[model samples]
Target: MEKLFKQVAIVVDQDDALVKNLENLVSLTREWQSSFHLIYVVERPAFSFKNIWKGYANGRTQPFDTAEHRLKEYQEKLKKLLPEGTRIHCYCKEGKPLWLIRNYIHENQIDLLLLLQSGSRFKRQPIRFSQLVGKINCPMIMVPLHKKDYDFKNIVLPISHELPLKKIMIASFLAGKKNDARIHLLALQEQDAKRQRTENPYLFKTYQLIRDNTTLTVECHPVDGDNLAAPTLEYARKVNADLILVKPGSETSPPGIFHRLLSKFNFSSSGIPVMTI
Candidate 1:
């Protein structure tokens, strides 16, 4: 059978903590046996004659070369963690990260992208994982820097009428692979009374789809909240869920300082790996 994620790409960074988490990710996805590609982009600064001359004069290693070295190190570490004979390739480039990564995904037909969420902050400086949310063609998994180990035993799938049911299948596929895994369908309660009544059919249909399609144990519960992310994450925490299956279009609070502070409470900061599928 064809694998769910046949071609997987991981965005490599210099964060030591995230690099440590690679072992956990590799171990978790061993079933898929997918080809893993590691990509590291060196953010290039504006050209300056003095900088170039200094590098040439001092024989300092170029930024691209440095990126290649780091990525090779990552490749070696992953090689040790991954099963023998698994395909691994490394790409080191100097350019705008967002552009390069998107292009790479398209050009290489990456089925899934794994990115590292740096140290306790949802919005990291210089590189924000959220920026690539809807931009990439394929789904991406955001693994928290502090997340050392995990199992797909308890997978959280927050369902709402507004969101697509595609994630249901993805959740089921993952949960079905592991021993004794369960999928929690957290229905987002609509604040408006009229909309709440109208949305029940969609919720029930989602529940039925999971029941008919997969044998994994399933649970459904109503979650109350206007901001979709907060309640979903809160429930995951309450249940001690192992993984959360989120979407690229998952709701977020308005852009402001208050929202920034609240974002810290989201799944990325909780050291839980969230798959934005």
Candidate 2:
């Protein structure tokens, strides 16, 4: 990993679904030695009677009482779950969840942002996540809420034109480098049958780059499909991959087909975790 993710931030949604999977996030930070912060946002009440409200002796109000108590419970549980001596800080905010998260990231200069795909706050549905995917300044990894545990023994990496190589290799390392994982590279080939017969030479180089760097058992598969996402997901299932690591377009570049598909994607429906850098 060229740039160490020394600081990580996880946005716990209103449901706290992702907070339940805190172990998975902690395990990711072990290698990087990143200290993470757990952040929860309480949406501002639809209507507030701030002017007429009489605060308690301590100045705590009734509307925010439940939110404060819930956050305290989460903080206690998370502190117990984290490794010994690991620095962890928890915060609760009141505002739009998305904006609060963005502001927090900018203020803290977080190196990585971890999020969960399952939650009730997503009234805007996939578009909400798509907004984050399109605009997050730091690398973000979103894990779908699933009943199963993560093995991370096999990772399926899809390679397309202008793939984000640096971010991807870093993510693969963090997700599975120590697990002795095998990175299966599924190259998205053009649909035209006569256009190409051989694998892209860059695949070998990428394999070499990852393998040499991490000693990971990197392999490649040529997938001929109309689009990258569908076949990539299929091949990922075929390999029984633990995670599908992708690199969304950078802020400077236009949104790619992958990013476009991700905007409308319901990751939980796929039953696999998708980590993007």
Candidate 3:
């Protein structure tokens, strides 16, 4: 299989949990043969309190030197610690962190964005997370504070009518890359799965097309109830899913809010990359 994720980046801050996050990035992309970039945004402030304390505090260390210092340190650590021959780059920019991160993701053609929930520069505003889900083109792996092993086996996805199969297939392809990882699909509506299979065969077509001789399995189920997120999570826990894929379009539709709130959870443990299309 071809490696689709060749370039990956991690958005970091002075206070982020870099040690564990970096370790996970290495593990997640080891198969991809990927290059890692450490991105630090200075967060261009909108107002006040600048000249009031502009002098160097500790000799060469200025008021704003801490972030830069941390970024440089991370760069050294990444290059020293990553697998031999792996490429590592560090970037530090002063601007709105979101825009800088977005622009960097686009310009660098980053295939994945690894972020730690704690010490993130942005306040983890639901709107910001929702916006990233709706706008950013890369798949992101968001790690929570507690460290737990998440696997691809029993990967679950919530598919709505508006969600594109191609997008869902992206996740399936990723999970299926590992032998024995099963991709389970759940239609967010109350409609019957057999009926939908009859009505729109493409909704269930991923298995036939994606799985061939691999241990990866594909199956779709109708959620049969309201509040799709809860049921989806419940089913995922029941199946012991290591990851949950939010179908495309759920980020922009009415369930957008649900996705936003759901972002707060530490889904990475189950191999849930905490990603959107």
Candidate 4:
């Protein structure tokens, strides 16, 4: 069978910690038999002498020779971190970091993009990142610097009353592959059981579909509150989940406090990664 994330790409920089953490993510992705591609974009200073020497130097505009040499050095350093027999490629591009990454995702049909969320140093502006999150068509997995090991024993997929059934099925199919992994289908509801039964028909349909689609064990439950992230985190801690998969809302109404809180919580503060579909 084909791997889940066949073409995975990771963005790296000079930060040793970010590089090391991203290496761990690549290791985990490889464990799932996914083809990996690592790209290190060197952000060069715009005012460098190479840019100044522009048209006068044989139509050369930048210090590409030096950049290429530096890129090779980074490739060698990264190569030492990977397991043997894993095929990896490196690319060195010059531009704004996030913009470059967004373009690369479009040009190459990258299945999943892994990014290291550096603390204050590389703090992504909420508005800007939110815009990219909306525009990017594929799934993006954000891995904080601390979360390295991917122990897939427990995973939680937060579903509201309005989620599509096909999305849930896709998540179930992934969870079923890992031995002993439990898939928790959480429904955060403000109404009682009888009210949910009358109001949310899709929820029932999703429950039935999960049961019929895969042999993987799944637990369906509801939380009696409007705060989706709170209950989702509680369930994750109780189950000791290695990852939490969530679906972002539409562009007009992007993921709110519930979604952002998951990434901001103490559980995700460490090594646990969150996958947003």
Number of the predicted model whose TM-score against the real structure is largest: 1
lDDT of 1 at 30: 86
The positional error of residue 60 in candidate 3, measured at the CA in angstroms, is: 21
What is the Cα-based TM-score of model 4? Answer: 0.72
Residue-wise C-alpha lDDT for candidate 2, range 154-210, written one tens digit per residue: 787777665457655564655554557678887755534677566656666777777
Sort the predicted structures by TM-score, highest score first: 1, 3, 2, 4
**Each candidate: what lDDT?**
0.72, 0.64, 0.61, 0.60
Question: Alpha-carbon error at 194 in model 1, in Å?
Answer: 6.4
Return the lDDT, model 4, position 228.
63
Residue 94 lDDT, candidate 2, scale 0-100: 70
Cα RMSD, model 4: 6.4
Better of 1 and 2 by TM-score: 1
Q: Name the lDDT value of residue 233 in candidate 4.
A: 66
The stretch of ten residues in a row with the least summed lDDT in candidate 4 is: 121-130
TM-score of each: 0.84, 0.75, 0.76, 0.72
lDDT tens digits by residue: candidate 1, 25-98: 78767888999999887665557988677644543324677668888898998899888999998888877889
lDDT string, candidate 3, 120-190, tens digits: 44333211344465567787666554545655566677665543555555565567556677777776444
In terms of lDDT, the best-performing candidate is: 1
Model 3, residue 100: distance off in Å is: 1.0
Which structure is stronger by lDDT: 3 or 4? 3
The candidate 2 region of ten consecutive residues with least summed lDDT is: 54-63
